[model samples]
Target: MSSRGTDVEDAVDSEVAAPARGTGTRRRVGYVAGLFGLLLLLLLGAVVVLVAQGSIAIPIGEVLRVLTGQDAQSQLSRTIVLDARLPKVVAGLLAGAALAVGGAQMQTLFRNPLADPFVLGVSSGAILGASIVILGTSGVGWLSGLGLVSQLGVTGAAVAGAAGVLLIALGIARRVGDPVVVLVVGVMLGYLAGAVVDMLVYYTDPDRLQALATFTRGSVRNVTWNELQVIAVSCAVVLVLSVFLAQPLNALLLGDRYAGSLGVNVRRVHFLSLASVAVLSGITTAYCGAIAFVGLAAPHLARGLLRTADHRVVLPASALIGAVIVLVAEYVAGGNGLTKTSLPLNSVTAFVGAPVILWVLLSGRARRQAG
Candidate 1:
């Protein structure tokens, strides 16, 4: 009788363990699925808000109608919705996602919480590249007439500039044990790029200066449908590449040695990551100007909210959050109802980003040296 009772208890224990494990697995799966759903909903909401609350306030119903297979409100509304507002929203969505993804990868690459896409001088390089094109072009009077070659050339130069900075920063980071030192090195690289941009601007024609100023401050209002085509194609290519890199990036978060043990080629991952980030940052800066903070803040916010340092989640999550932040900023600054003039994208973003950056610094997260 004692032996039989023991056997029955053993069977119960086994049954309980199986369900326990199963329940845990289901919970985790549900949590991740829920987060993904929330992100999708947020992005959808951002699109709705951006379209509905523009300079000419289109009704939510109208926005929904146009989004569906419905007819045009007017030729003007149709053009505005399809041509102007939609492209701007799309550009914001893409640009935000690109910057945030790049920035999130950068944080993981550096193994530091505060690392952002612009920290490694990508934005400055892009600005320098775009400035050169603007100063040299004849067809675009003061940044007015950039054709495809010039745009591609600018994006290429920006990518080159970004790659150059990444190589240098990576070298410095590898040699330096302290995260603070690495961040300082990044800052210096940015300053150097900014100095170069300044020198180019100084020698540039006064007529060209206006365009340079606009690009540096950042704005999505000026992007036409044709220019957006370039952005869409390039961003789509880079984004797909990002999805493929996500798993490898996860291995990396466990440390280079561990990743190597797990059969990940760290060097190849680094090279590909640098290229991907360069393309993402460069193309966005070329089209929309150097919009700051989204790259810097989006990843940080996503990680904080998700409570995981894992890049696999951080990367896509950052993209979705970035789209939300940028579109909201656009609505605020798009000169819809409050005023006739729009606010600079940089200005609105910095207002939020600067404080978060300061918080990081004050909390010693940015200042901490990796031991």
Candidate 2:
């Protein structure tokens, strides 16, 4: 009742509330860290299992030995683990991470939950670029057979194609100033690119078409160490750059005007993000073929699990989730050695992605109705 007594009581309550808030913050951080650790373990497990369980069935011990620089029991085991399965597994990791990060960036940049490289024509652009090179070149065999110079040329073409589509889409998006319109434009661009690729395939030699066919049906098996070098360097660089862009991306989520008010160079952020996505999507498509859905699904899954759209968390979480999805899909597709014929990576990814797409649509609809 007295002023002094009341003041003392208020100070005591403030101290108690501060400690409670700190504890809650610590608990949340721990929960997130635990989830990340579990994801990492799953990734490591998937890698080992995939590398070990191919047609030859290398033992897990030998797989670890080869991975850890120890000698395998047999030279054949070493070759199978290293020269065969390891590349594919590594490619899966890199491609998944790249696509997922690209997808997360696309979703933020466009402010559309469904935006992704595959959906938005970036992957198709890369495919068209590579198809032109593959269809135009004389006596070209499979991608792996191409010399390093030729391979680089094709990869370069893919990057250019991705960039071309991205620039066009961004320009149209700027002019229209509508996310829905941008989405439609992107889909149309994808269709146009696909039509051109189809025409090229129709006119090309049947034998040459085999190389192009692999581009549509995603598979990492063909990625050689040589090709891996390109995928590794480009994806690594772009992925690292994405880390730096996370804050700017989060700012963009609040809207360009607000982001600009906050001193974010909206145009520069857009350029860098678009460029990074182009590079990531293009390089992954070049090596692994037009893998689908990992990008689209991974970001959604990451956000759902992490329960946050903060790019700092979503970006890395999406990478790990995407890698795990690819590895699991690869195993199911034929890496398990259960079937003589392997399913396309896209086929497997569809099983995972389709449900997520539906869930997103339904959840969004529910939110709108409730609002």
List the candidates' TM-scores in order: 0.91, 0.97
- For each candidate in the order shown, give its overall lDDT on alpha carbons: 0.81, 0.91
User: Cα RMSDs of all predictions?
Assistant: 2.9, 1.3
- List clashing residue pairs in candidate 1: 140-145
lDDT of 1 by residue, 1-371 (tens): 99999999999999999999999889877887798799899888889777777668888778878888598676676677787788888999999999999888887788865677677677887777767777788744424576677778877877777777877888888998577788888888889989988888788777778777878888877777888898999888988888888888899888899999999999999888888888888889888888888888888888777777777787888889888888878878863546778888888988768887887677674456642
Candidate 1 lDDT: 0.81
Best by lDDT: 2
State the TM-score for model 1: 0.91
Name model 1 segments beyond 4 Å from true: 1-14, 139-143, 358-371
